[model samples]
Target: MTERSKEQEQGGQVRELLATRADEVSLPDGWADRVLRDGKRAVGRRRLAATTAAVAAVAAVGVLLSGLPGTGEQPPASRPEWATADSVPQALRKMPVGPDTDVPYGTRGEQGKGALRVMLGGRAIPIPKEYTGLRIWRAGDRGFVYLADGPGDVSVVVHVDADGTSTELERTAKGEHTTQLNVSEDGRFAAWTVHPYEGRSQVVKRADLTTGKVGSRSYDDIDSVHGFAGDDVLINWDARVQNIGSLDRDGTPWPSADRDGGVEDYSVASDTVLLSTSDGCMRAYSIAQPDNQRWKVCDMEDVHFSPDGQRFVALREGGYVVSDTSSGEVTGGLWSVPSVHPQDMAWEDDDTVLLELAEAKPARTKDGMIAPIAPQYGPSYLVRCHVEQERCELVDTGGPVKAFPSSSS
Candidate 1:
């Protein structure tokens, strides 16, 4: 059957999946490398600045030169191939722009300062202070629901109406460093990890957004909550094992979603699961029938599925590719410079996506030459790409925006 016909056959299930897919977003890739490189650079700068006063001026200049692009300190970022103004590809022409209406998008405080902001009704609505980590999804016509991390490991689950009214719900503590908040696409359920002191296993807490009632299930080895597939919660079983499994709403273990290997992603909307293995390949499977494989790709990593489950973006060696989910057809691909990589992607609308290009820290090679870029570094840029038009433009969201994609919160 044609992919279109197969999609149509799914009917309401597909629609429901797409609706929830809006809330699904990929986390920043290479986060560890970025943090490590950033830390090293920061220390080097600090030590240089603290040098003897006689050489302070020279050291300051040296620091400045070290950070400048193409100065042997770091490689210059090259423009994405598909975004080049001089060479437009036919495959990207006449691309659909998806929906025109505004959706609630997520943003962090500049430099992770201030409160997390949500752009809604043409204005930025700031969430509560000390923004730890946050996830947002539309609350039907009422406005948006935010699952935010507050000061002191507090989990803030609140709903904001269209008129700017905020109604906060009560939930258990979200334990320290618990930043990821996964919500169902319909905004009906939210899941997070709760680590109590002296506990044997962390508890995965599921909160009902509508009734404000909370349910808890304890697992001996849950590394984190992946997300919700329908009302079932997906979890990363153990850090070492890297197993993916599911749990019922009441927190009972459900092996139906069980799979080995790290999770590339789990589409809560479509109940589709993507897993990556050691051989450097990824495969998509139905969450319901775990054995039912949908598609698989080799030598690809960092997969992010679109909200409609029609397409996905994945990173290859030189750059990234956008592909059909069912058939694994390569729809479009872009060549990227070695200095930068497409670290993250989020669906801005139906046809447009936001890509974050991250710079890597330059290292010294043999013969006293500087090494090329690696996929590590913070403070990345946001580029919005139109899938059909095959065109991408750098997105400037007023001030400095975080490297993460702005989800429909």
Candidate 2:
């Protein structure tokens, strides 16, 4: 009779979701206006800076006083009533302080430089040459290069002795697949989900900068870990066998075995698994469990947490659902994406979800004949129906390619 029991009895719906076209969705009001305002402010700054020389001749300290058109008039970033920065777990706030590189988190590479860069507070410091998909990880007296080579292989290289130069320390074997990559908060260690071809399918590994030694922490019988908390790594392998466990910097195992659960797919924030799934549906899980596990299922359809784990959003019939997980409630949809995370979703902001929809596009490649063409990303929706708002809106990103979450590999 109850939803939980109903889920237990039938194993819930194992149905695959359907995708749709993009043009059907509508953009919310003020969305474009807001972006336009930001653009104008940026343009105004260039004009002001150029005129500084002339302004000095005409007036006294006047250039600094110009304040631009909407400088003071712009509204503060709208923080949703339910989304509080403090409400987020402490681990997220624990990301460390270190030297930065000019690489963007998910970018492959650009302008002869690697796409990856070291970032903090949204500011990115270039990681030297921006190559495509190169993630820059900072370690004490070293800089490590990580590539989000999908759910398959990953590349790791180290740069030593800050002449702003580098060297390739090691390149893992081809058969090994990397799932999770955690950069230590202290910038002294790195943890990765290493699936070596010869031995166990996957294991947690830690690399120490000082000794140049990489070794396994104890193995949790799971597919891979979601992420790390501080220097502690969290492992989750199977829907039924998966458990959340911790590994210290020295590769020491935390006392608790792991939080047992049926997790089909999930995502992690600094210390918590903000999104989790079982055979039935994807729900938000809490990291505060006594044994370190607790997940509450919502009525949301195809639900997931944001890449930053600051918000909860989902897709349902003709609408989407965005909710606050800390509280057992629905924030409803910000707007309909005409889809939600259809194939994969990317967060454009706190208010919108970028849906990568699936559609049958005729392809010329030979692989298309055997496999259903991997769906392409459609558009970025500036939704409001997200989180139970009065109405929902949408924005078109005009995409038709594979995409992933910003902070997620």
Candidate 3:
């Protein structure tokens, strides 16, 4: 049998076994209802111990038998002790100032209220007032990139240094909306897409920090900037072709493997571009050879690769799963969170991810059943999950705020 076929057959068999095992595990009738009742009561009484116990029980059962034969590889044998919400201290954990320890992050502040702030070591460092409405791209211990409303209603790219010095780069006409800013891993080149209001034409812009040179290219139907592979900017044009080339050139185009469904989102790494298809599959393509295709995972949505490009996290049915990039082996048990936004999730390190936890409200259904209500963008808290160790801790940020890891961290 071909290698791909063999892999498919093995995956099918393992999934079947998991399904059967789930069915064979017996529990008391109305277990979900009982758990909900007790959980609600525990929360009302402010008994954190009970809640932690309940969470631990659920996490214990989340480990699937992924060590079956034909699976690529197994996870590390030593796992850290699982942490509970109560066990995690209710204080901002101070990240040491060092080569690979500090994590710089940006928070959403009231627009036109004051200067923007980036949180580091539990302290808020203020940026210049001109760069007020800032959306951070690449943050590091040294410098960062962001987009803000410049003078004359134009959108300007601002680069800030750790010493509080800032420089405003190229300015584009403020369009109907602005896409996220993407910077190379080295914090040198930055790219983003601008959609003009009148013409409806899309432009991909890139700036080189070393030379202070900015260039752009206009495309009829360019979607957004994925990221920077090396010096080249990866573009998703027309929602059909994912091109990898220079910002000054036409570039090479690779047709989406799932052309019928289209590409939902994509992330560029050192050697490959990970594309999440709308039909719920993660596909990887070589940057050097666009035509080379490899299927990574199936039935997984909202896929994102870790910053280091060694692992990836994807949303499964009930929760999220982390897998090795090369082997595609499930390295950690399922991680459950309340109404997680996959796009908001990012890697703090190889073994940990910073996730936004949505707030849930109880709602009564027509049948007199109580259900939890959650909104896409609601009051959210940041939590750090240790994937391999199956532990999570709430990051005390004082209140609900959006946070992302600095590229250097």
Candidate 4:
């Protein structure tokens, strides 16, 4: 069967799973209340600035599961609060314009003239000279996470504001490599994971961008860090278990879910942990209740939750699909592009996504198996898609583009 057919088969199986459970899974009594109470307690303990509003919003929505049969009535359609043209947050509004070029990620020699630029407000904004040669991760429009190599083989994670000021959030000594850095949806904290070459333990660290206070916890045999769920960090340890725990305290084991198929990747929201399993299924587990899981089977390989966690973008059959995390309903139609890497996509806002389109030609083996493209492939462009409107526009980033985390609250 063709790849599209396989995706359809998987989608059909998922529908069947949901259909079988429709009558059996009713909204648990006081679920909303419990979620709110628990969420508030967690937020208060962590003093998280970013997730406070989100927890409240989820409470107001009541039903967490989308498209479930038990919801009494469908709510009237209303524009998302961040959908307006003016809704682009202030941090992302004004960027310093610069010369445009097609080679954004090229080497110094390959960049003929002018500095590299990033696409902001559809204009190419020159990257500050101080940020040149550093790996830049946009942390919302509010600021950036710059991974720069320092003296003595140390690496620093610097937080740079949109206006060009910066502060060092954290630093790593030699032998430790920072594998992932994720800014919380609210932009108050930056959480990252570090792997040590000499040790088996993986360290998860969080820097309070507001206070400059940093905290961390270490786990044995950690596979990856899946960002933050409110104040706590989500970690996949030993390749088979996922845990959510505080970064400041070391104590009793936090709540965990064991996956037999192994976890491929995961995204955490305040109320739920969405896992993309090795078996090719997406599972949502309630943070308040770990044993409860809702599964959706599909051909989605990589899963990325929007800043608010209300929606997610997944790769299906060489294209992109945006869906409601709760209901698994596609909000936008399929977007077909030449090549999209999960790491190369970021949510511009709740309703928009920024994608990096690679120009490399896909390689087909003798048996017709497509080989993965390396990052070095030449020429890429930045494309911004409005998920709700189902339209995309090309933006000029002097070179390749890397999206930072959203800073909007």
RMSD of 1: 18.6
Specify the highest-TM-score model's number.
Answer: 3
lDDT of 2 by residue, 79-149 (tens): 23222234222211121111112222232233213444443223433443433344444443344435444
Which candidate achieves the best lDDT against the true structure? 3
Measured on C-alpha atoms, candidate 3 has an lDDT of 0.55
Q: Model 1 over residues 1-409: C-alpha lDDT tens digits?
A: 9755654454434333333332343213432232122211311111322122213223322433445421112211222332233222221121211111245665565543666687665667777667556666655455676766676656666777677777775444544334445666555766667655444347766667666667766678566666666666666664222222233424434343345554544443475666675556676766566678777777777666677767777677757777787777777764354655556666665676666565554666788677674423534545556565343444434333442432321
TM-score on alpha carbons, each prediction: 0.59, 0.46, 0.64, 0.62
**Candidate 4 Cα errors over 4 Å, as ranges:** 1-135, 150-152, 240-244, 250-255, 339-343, 362-376, 398-409
> lDDT of all the models against the reference?
0.52, 0.39, 0.55, 0.53
By TM-score rank, best first, the candidates go: 3, 4, 1, 2
lDDT of 3 by residue, 154-195 (tens): 777776666656677657754554555787866778777787
The TM-score, computed over Cα atoms with residue i paired to residue i, of candidate 3 is 0.64
lDDT of 4 by residue, 79-112 (tens): 2232222423221122111222222222222232
